[model samples]
Target: MTLPSRNIFRYKTETRQSMHSLSPFMSDDVVPGVNHSPVKAPRKVPRSPYKVLDAPALQDDFYLNLVDWSSHNVLAVGLGNCVYLWNACSSKVTKLCDLGVDDCVCSVGWAQRGTHLAVGTNNGKVQ
Candidate 1:
């Protein structure tokens, strides 16, 4: 029977000097302090200025974009087949447009300039 040859390490070995001391500073008598107290978060409360008013006939479908508020403080809402514009500053509501009975208002959006309004209908028309 032939004996198998054993692999030997053939690389040059070098030792590096550590910048920090390697002395064991930790002892069995030393105990770690506990910081198990729960952190408290700052309390935040919301304030409302006006009373709640029911917006009837407003579409509640999540997939449908039905209402939009403009930077000019104008709120445009699509109710059934009609598009109503509410001015936050003046506190007035005006009917912007009313679509035909066959088509209901699907979505309403305001221009960035706040000068124009866009309304979408179920019958595939944007006005």
Candidate 2:
């Protein structure tokens, strides 16, 4: 959804079974830290004041549950049993993981001390 803040849009998921968070610094080689939670998400684009830098066709996977952004990349999970890491700048697809959770993610978090992440799920589990 477009926020009243203008130029700010909120993206949510459709099948929020699990949410994930990735630190921006880890990637392309290292696994980086991941956090999971219960949340259904699909690729989607809410109205934005600024021109969307990415392709317009990706508005379908709006995440409804939880998402996290580090200094670099973003992580999200849905009911698809797979985790996704997105590039914040170019709106590019980065990492995908079939964690086998196969449920819903409720929330995601970035570790303040480091580049790690934490994920929460409705199944009463944390990863």
Candidate 3:
């Protein structure tokens, strides 16, 4: 047996009434009948970096976080087995420590005071 044909595309009065009731809660700026246009000011931003620092032997592993910024505006980067600290104010790069050729740095983090730095190595050593 065949089922009776039904108009699936018939206009829904209930949907229209519900939407009309919610019109008061909706923003006037987004409604179709509203004429007001919001003005947005353009933001100014530099297209390129102001300064660039060369970091050699920086690891590209996604799981390893080899760089960290301290509260004192100092950036610590782990490159190979060596850890370097770059000061943003002076633009000076200082070699903090070297784990030697036998082991490579896995991660680096700065203490809350920004005075101490923690270095993690692939050989399960923290320096």
Candidate 4:
């Protein structure tokens, strides 16, 4: 008992014909009610960073947030036992504080007004 051979070409032609009869747009050229204007490509973006800062002994701990950007465009970074403040506008780096050899900076944060910065140390102290 052998099954009848199927004609793939004939099946595809029938399917195409049925689809063309059902849809208003038969050909692949254009849709029945749509504009076919050329679309503008997006503008190219710079691959490199605008600026870079050298941060020595910056902690790579997952739970610690050692870097923070203030609303006044100041960047606070905790590097080992010292916390430094970098002004984005002037590009000036200032030494905010040093926790000394006994303590290491854990995290750094800026105040809401961006006028003050808080530094947390591993010795359970906040400066």
**Tens digit of lDDT per residue, candidate 2, span 1-89?**
85484334647544542222354643445443543446789878777656433322222445434556665455443334444666666
The estimated TM-scores of all candidates read 0.61, 0.39, 0.67, 0.66
* Model 4 steric clash pairs: none
Q: Give the clash total for candidate 4.
A: 0
Among these predicted structures, which one has the highest TM-score? 3
lDDT of 1 at 51: 46
lDDT of 3 by residue, 55-118 (tens): 9778788999899999999999999989999999999989988898899999999999998999
Highest lDDT scorer = 3
At residue 12, what lDDT does model 2 achieve?
Answer: 52
**What pairs collide in candidate 1?**
none
lDDT of 1 by residue, 16-62 (tens): 63333353764434444633459899897659646454579876798
**lDDT (C-alpha, whole model) for all candidates:** 0.79, 0.53, 0.85, 0.84
For model 3 the TM-score comes to 0.67
Candidate 1 segments whose C-alpha is farther than 4 A from its true place: 1-49
Give the runs in model 3 whose Cα sits over 4 Å from its true position: 1-40
TM-score computed on alpha carbons, candidate 4: 0.66
- 33-104: candidate 4 lDDT, tens digit per residue: 665668889998899978877897787889898999999999999998888899999999999888889999
Better of 1 and 2 by TM-score: 1
Error of 3 at 109 (Å): 0.4
